[model samples]
Target: MTYELRDHTADVAVEATADTLSALFAAVADGLAAASAESVPDEGDRFEFEVAAEGREALLFDYLDRLIYERDVRLVLPADHRCAVVGPGEGDSGTGPSDPDEWRLTASARGVPLDAVAAREIKAVTYSEMALERRGDEWYAYVVFDV
Candidate 1:
C-alpha cells in the first residue's frame, strides 16, 4: 500500500492506492492519521470500532469520519489501521458487496492521546473530490480533510 499527500484549495488531501479493499482502507486511514499529527508514537492505546454503509464510497467516508470522531472524543491521534469489509453487514441480509446492501467495516487502530504527541486540528473529512475505485489490479482512494 502507498499514500501521498496532495495539495488542496483550502485544506489537505491524500491519495492512496493498494492491492485490496482492506489495504486501501488502512492506507487512507494512515494518511489521515499522519495528516493529523506530526509523528506517531511507537506505542499507543489500541481500540476497535465498527461502521456500516451502503457502498464503498460511503463506507470510506464513514470510516474516516469515525476516526476523526474518535480523535476528538478521546483526544487521540489514531494510526496503525486494520480494516475488515463485509457485505450484508452483521445483521443485514443481502446478496453481496454490489447488492446495495449494508457493508460493514470493523476497524482496529492504535494511537496515543493528544498529550503524548503534537497534533493538528483536523475538523472533519469532506466529500469534496473524494473518491474510491478499483483501477486495474489496485484500489484507489482520494480524500480531503477539513482542517
Candidate 2:
C-alpha cells in the first residue's frame, strides 16, 4: 500500500493505491492519520469500527468520514490501520454492481490520545473529485478533505 498527500485548493487531498481494495482503504486511512499529526506514535491505543455503504464511492467516503469521526469524538491520533473489505460486496454473486447497499468495511486502527501528540484537525471528507477504481492490477483512491 502507498499514499501521498496532494494540494486541493483550499482543502487537502490524499492519493492512495494498493494491490487490493482492502489495502487501498488502509492506505487512505494511513494518509489521513499522517495528516492529523506530524508523527503518530505507535504502541498507544486501539479502536475498531465497521462501515457499510451502497457502493464503492460511498464506501470510500464513509470510511474516511468514520475515521475522522473517531478522531474527533474520541480525541485520538491514529498510528496504524488495518482495513478489510468484508461481506458480500457488490458483484460478489454475478449480480453486477446493481446493489449499492450491500458493501461493508471492517477497520481496526491504533493511536494515542490527542493530547499525547501534535495533531491538526480535519474538518470533514468531501465528495469533490473523490474517486475509487481499479486500473490494471492496482486499486486507486483519491479523496479530498475539508481541512
Candidate 3:
C-alpha cells in the first residue's frame, strides 16, 4: 500500500493505492494521520472504531471524519492503522454469497498522545474532489481534507 500528499490551495489531498480495498482504507487512514503530525511513533495506545454506509466513498469520508473527532476528543494522534471494509448487507440472509449492496468499515489503530507529537490541526475531511475506484487488481482513492 502507498499514499502521497497532494498540494491544495488551503487544504491537503491524499491519494492512495493498494492491492485490496481494506488495505486501501488503511492507507488513506495513514495519510490522514500523517497530515496531522510530522512524525508518529510506531507504538501507541490501541483504538478501535466502526462505520457503515451505502457506498465506499461515503464510508471513507465517515471513517476519516470519525478519526478527526476521536483525535479532538481523545487528544491523540492516530496511527499504525489497520481496517477491514465489509458489505452493506453483511449479516442479511437474503444477499446470499453474492456482493452486498452496502458497506462497512471496522478499523483498529494506534493512538499517540497529542502532547507527544509535533502536530498540526486539520479542521475536517471534506468531500471536494473526493474519489474512490478500482482498476484491475488495485484500488485507488483521492480524499481532500480541510486543513
Question: Per-residue lDDT of 18-79 in model 3, one digit per residue for the tens?
Answer: 99999999999999988888898776789888777778898899999999999999998889
Q: Give the clash count for each candidate.
A: 0, 1, 2
**TM-score for each predicted model, relative to the true structure:** 0.90, 0.88, 0.90
The candidate 3 region of ten consecutive residues with least summed lDDT is 90-99
Candidate 1: tens digits of C-alpha lDDT, residues 6-113:
879889999999998989999999999888887888778899988888888899999999998898888888889999877563453333444446788888999678
Compared with the true structure, model 1 gives a TM-score of 0.90
Model 3 TM: 0.90
> Which model is ahead, 1 or 2, in terms of lDDT?
1
Predictions in order: lDDT: 0.86, 0.83, 0.87
Candidate 1's C-alpha runs over 4 A off are 88-100
Quote the RMSD, in angstroms, for model 1.
3.6
| Candidate closer to the true structure by lDDT (higher is better), 1 or 3 | 3
Which stretch of 10 consecutive residues in model 1 shows the poorest summed lDDT?
89-98
